[model samples]
Target: MKKFQVVVKCSLGIHARPAAQIAQACSNLRAAVTLETDHETAQGNNVLEILNLHAAKGATVTVTVDGPDEEEAAQKIQAVFEAMGPKEKKVPVLKVAFFGTKDYDRLY
Candidate 1:
């Protein structure tokens, strides 16, 4: 068995995309992969379960892989987490100025 920790960096937490990527990483492996956060544990290859973990930003997740391909599975999942790290928010920033006034408003 092998275990490693991953920090959740996605602004939206462990949402669908990361879950899918985690699942895909384990698709061809012969190991049993599981992910555990402070509140929950999930099967690494199951998207729904992975999502269910609700690992928010900055959450530490423990990845555990056991069986014949444990090393490969662990490495692949680690790569996926690294590749899925934090993303820039796409929200538009807005700035407004009032006429004849040194006042401005900003929205993120």
Candidate 2:
């Protein structure tokens, strides 16, 4: 078994997007991963379980991976959390714009 701690960085916490991403990543690994925060433990590969954690920004979360690939799984899960946004930093929503090109009319 392997365990590591990560801080939540998303502005909205582990909401749908982050939760889904984490779940998918964990699901790809062979280890049994779980996340612990605020005295609550959640299955890392379950979107709903992770979402139920309600881990807000700056909150420290502990992830545990157990099985044959525990070490690699821990590292991968840690990387995912680290690349989420920023440690202890909140992400701001940005507006995006789409530009039309010469082929736009053809597609329309």
* Candidates' C-alpha lDDT: 0.87, 0.86
As for candidate 2, its clashing pairs are none
10 residues in a row with least lDDT, candidate 2: 99-108
Candidate 2 ranges beyond 4 A from true positions: 86-108
Give lDDT: candidate 1, residue 59.
93
lDDT of 1 by residue, 8-64 (tens): 877788899889999998878999998999889998789999999988889999988
What TM-score does candidate 2 get on C-alpha atoms? 0.75
Clashes of 2: 0
Model number with the top lDDT: 1
What does candidate 2's lDDT look like per residue over 18-100, in tens digits?
89989988998888998999778899889998988989998999888889998788877877787788456578999986666
